[model samples]
Target: MAASLAAPAPAKGAWLETWLAAAPAASGELALVQQRGREALRQQPIPSSRNEDWRFTDLALLQTLPLTAASPAPAALPEVASGALRLNWNGSSDPLVDQALPAGLQQLSADEIAQGLGHTLAAAGCEQHWPVELNHAAAEHVLALRVTSRSQVSLELVSAAGAGLQALRLLLLLEEKAELDLSQLIEAQGSGLHSLVIEAHLARGARLSHGLVALGQADAALLAHVAMEQEPESEAQLSSVMSGWGLARLEPRAVQVDGAAHTTLRGLQVVDGQRIADTHSFVEFKGPEGQLDQLHKAVAAGQGRSVFNGAVRVPRAAQRTNAAQLSRNLLLSDRARIDTKPELEIVADDVKCAHGATVSSLQTDELFYLQSRGIDADQAAALLQRAFCEEVLRELPAAARSWCSLERLLEAAV
Candidate 1:
């Protein structure tokens, strides 16, 4: 049986209908999947404040936007170094992948994607989620990456759209003993709405290191969803950094299908002006000896708002599970707001679980100490802020840890 979550309330107005009508036609098994997604959208309501999961997020702005399919003209491709596969999706341009692939990696074509739609659709269960269903119904193409052996590969996923609405879907598969390092960068230009959905599967002993960074224009809104399933002895590490979007939501979910699995999640969100950044994550352990460590940090300046909700579940069969979650937030302005919740539900008596949350401002004594040591006030504050974010950034893959754009964003935030 497929697992389900409460769908976002049905969206108001004809945005859905209009977007659906404008979508390109799909054939074969892919068509069937889109049909199912369309039907599901017709049945599910857009999420509203009434829904507990979306209570802190106001969808008024999203509801008022005139949504349409993105149609940006193709621009010159950016220069990227060798040794990694780069995919650029600008809603209208043809998807691009590196010319050469590593020994154990393969990229799936449209026909191959169509043939595998059924399995992918089943694993995603898009019928139960609104954003995911919309992605399924409107995505221009399906991008898939398959790893079949003990290999190390880097992927750069770039999403840029013009005005209106854009959606993209990515599927990643790691066979037994396989490993992958993925870096996703979302750059939303102009005024519009963008949605991204990623589905990944890891077989026994497989490992995945995933990182994401989102940068958006002043009027852009984004919704990103990531779901992963892991077999016994599988491991996953997810790290994310967000900023610049007017309104954005990042949701990542993981399930341990067998025993002795390990999962780690870390995130840092920085917002200024009137922007809002929200993150919601869920992790479930289905068997014994599972472990999870999660930490999320937010820094809000100006009148920006940051929201975080993390939940971890340890079922009855998940004995000897170890889980810890923490949410740390810093407010740089009196007007800025931070809302955080760390939760755990453990049904096994042998499990050890702990959760905590903190909302604070720059420590006065620390600032004073820095000032006394010859640093100016502004420099002191920036240093402290950088240190606070390092806890999460340090966990990113080495190459991604030094992302220039990310570093600049952090400096600007301070």
Candidate 2:
């Protein structure tokens, strides 16, 4: 059973107080949700080395940040072609749409959203994580999207930063037979903290593909959490690329309410200097005939560090399930570090599940093979690195795969 968010003492700590003072006021259902979030934070202490889930990542810098609300800033929408929904957030809401939305897609207002907030929160199992509660407490807006058609649509979420904390919340629902292609770009420009929570629900026969890119300043910190619920015959694919943050953590969780659902997760992280990038994922199958394919790759240069932990759970009822998880990493410097753990837990009698993790440096033989072909050492290394990352990058949607910014991101890594 999840922990109860009953009446509790007000949250303490300078960071909590700063966030509360800067946050905007809410009323009615929204206010109640915020209060519950506050109580949850008060009841549970901050995570530290004592917690197994967070042992590998340090939180000293996060604890000392002046975590206030992000101040409003003017942001121009990115240059996206028509037929895309662009949402720019610089402590305010600016939605740019070049084309009209398809028939079954609509955005919900705060009051309209409150009607279904309870079920949405419950379905996401929000009580299990603290960062989610913090997001609920500080998020200034609740951007809710509902899709009910078989049409293809694009969504972009852009987050601009201020001097303090930036919190954002998103809820997405897809009815039966619906399809959506979503992309999110987060850019933090200053020395502060950013938190985001995304809750998604996919009904039977629904399909969703999500892509995310996170770029942060040298002194910035980021924490992003995603929760998804899938019904029978539903499918979801999540692809993420992250870099440039001083400290960052990305957690994605999915649960299959019924069986026969398909879930795919792919992630790539490139970090250098003193940056730290961490990703943790969890997928649970509750019924039979479920399938999951997961791959996570990381490249660490200079004195950077990369961490990954992925787990898939199949209960007794989840018979005939097929799941595979792999984590591959590369280290370019002696001082760089990579920690990866891929896990599978199965209680079913008949199921196929496999998990493996590998950590190595650029192979001398492979590098030599490329260099011998008339390519300079630097160019050869870059070529090899790009090849290493392409395995996961190719899994993105074609539109996202063709983005020039993504090409620049890979070049910058080299």
Candidate 3:
């Protein structure tokens, strides 16, 4: 039996107990938002080095530091602009940061809050290690968002430093036949971990176009979990470009629960400078007549490491489900490395699911050809690298363009 608490210990022993304990609890549907997370943490502790899922990553990096409680700082008008999305952080106090978002997207009901639960190892599978363990434990740094209408909301989410172990809960609900085009930016200061749990609820005939790009301090780690449920005739065209320093992980997970919902996922991962980056994506078809398409790209150079995992599962009830996943990797140097895994689990009798992976080095012939021309070997390699990434870059929407100035990003990365 679970031990009872006068209230409840702070979440996951995240080391943010005092900070979260000082925040106010939710009064709406997500009434016990903070309490439930704490309870869940109390029941199942986050995995450490013993867990396989996190074996490649370090969990103790979070427990070692004595981080001062995270507080929201005032943000001025963003210097950059893309797709009409302008971001301004007017938050002074951490408590008031919860209310700082545009009032157009606040829906903190109990059911909605409950839906945000279960991202933990205890919620998914006991054996796996969750990346957002500490963030979930803090629970106080959550932001719930609801997108209605054809929302052309351009967003730039900045993860400023000094705010260690924070969770940004984004709840987006697209109304019937509504549309949402969003762009996300994650930049952190100091060496701290930041996680964002994005819960998207798409109504019948709704559509969502989303993109995310992140960068952090060398010792920091970050994760983003996107959960989406698309109704009949709804569509989600999603793409991402992740370029960062340090140990970073990106996971895009979604389930189609009804009708003809479609999802398109395209991703790019670049690692160098002894940095390690991983991108994991999963799309599940739980309803009838839905389709999903996924493509991933990874490039590892120097002594850097990279990993890509793309999975698609179709349940028996999901008749006429069509799914496809592909992963491609490029190793620029002999020391550079990449681990690519593509998986498909389909129980549906009538469905189409396929997966493929490829790893190779830069073509010497191409290099020779470029050198044969006016281009030198180094320039040729950079050009080829640029071309190799062009496909993924072109797949991104306006949201991605703002987050990752790809051309500028690659100049330094390559």
Candidate 4:
């Protein structure tokens, strides 16, 4: 870890100042992003800790990451996830990496990146926000791409940053009838810091399927922001299966401006030993005729910590919209902890919205049923556990393969 990435001077009530003080001086877009951070010092930094959304995994760990805008030496990519497509960047410049993107997929220009980031960040209502200023200040190299309707594309992006932080800026456009299987895995042999900013746009009558997963050392900071915008009559299914062997932070936000758009979001994670994983998601239905469904699950063992904070907001204009969200946790050890919160806000009357969250131990009846078969207690528990998580993976494009492989993975985890 760079001394700069370590803690900076303790400047009371000045998060941005402290951050900038520790950041390396630079020029151009990256510099502007830094200046934006300097400006954020005025506002009270969103207090994230044991009392806030970060009640589970304390964000004090984030301070350990070097906030510099330094370039990372090119990192290698992983071919498959732990079992399937682990570290699967596949050398992609875009989220859906390909030697030649399909006809409908194209990178967005600087002007387009500017338009998308500004439009989405406007929701936070944080005047002079660091994220917005940083986005405007820095225009990362490479063009963000889009995959339009009815398009069937399977792509991967894998990278290994030997040391320090490397940034990837992706702009994804998914049009109607477009389908995408996007898988990304980031890892490094040494300490590697990674920053990813992705903006996705789904057009009318289009459908999108996306997945993100990562595994790496705990000494580095991984800040990922995903902004998704949807048009009318569009459908999206997004899944995240993250492995937290090290420290990990993921913030994925999705917004729907027009009505008739539906989306299902789910996240699955397994944590053991002394690891920390955090996920924050916000879904906004700004128009009428929208529907959003969210399901989050986690299994924690040993001294590990896992968190899931999800929110669904239906503005007044969102009449006839239906939204349901749930967060579930399976704790495997007494010392381990799982924090979960599911929120729902509906300003429009006559709209159907429900939210619930629960954490509990395995059912004895289910364990008994498995034991009654010719299986031992351990095998019985693994069998029941696999069945519990199957629903989340049921929507996978390659469900059959995932089923078999996941069964084996469960057996190994047990």
Error of 1 at 141 (Å): 1.1
TM-score quality measure for candidate 1: 0.89
The residue pairs that clash in candidate 1, if any, are 8-46, 8-47, 9-45, 9-46, 9-47, 10-45, 10-46, 11-46
lDDT of 4: 0.63
lDDT of 1 by residue, 325-380 (tens): 99999999999999998889878999889999999999999999999999999999
Task: Write candidate 3's Cα lDDT for 353-383 as tens digits.
Answer: 7889999999989999999999988789888
Candidate 3 residue spans exceeding 4 A from truth: 1-31, 48-52, 63-66, 70-85, 89-129, 149-153, 407-414
Q: Candidate 2, clashing residue pairs?
A: none
lDDT for model 1 comes to: 0.78
Q: Number of backbone collisions per candidate, in order?
A: 8, 0, 7, 24
Candidate 3 clash pair list: 29-109, 29-110, 30-109, 30-110, 85-154, 143-169, 145-171
The parts of candidate 2 lying over 4 Å away from their true place are 1-13, 21-29, 71-78, 90-100, 109-112, 118-126, 402-407, 410-414
Q: Rank the candidates by TM-score, best first.
A: 2, 1, 3, 4
Structural similarity to truth (TM-score) of each candidate? 0.89, 0.89, 0.80, 0.78
The list of candidate 4 runs beyond 4 A from truth reads 1-47, 63-99, 123-143, 148-150, 396-414
Regions more than 4 Å wrong, model 1: 1-11, 21-29, 64-66, 71-82, 91-98, 109-127, 404-407, 410-414
Question: Which 10-residue window in model 4 sums to the lowest lDDT?
Answer: 83-92
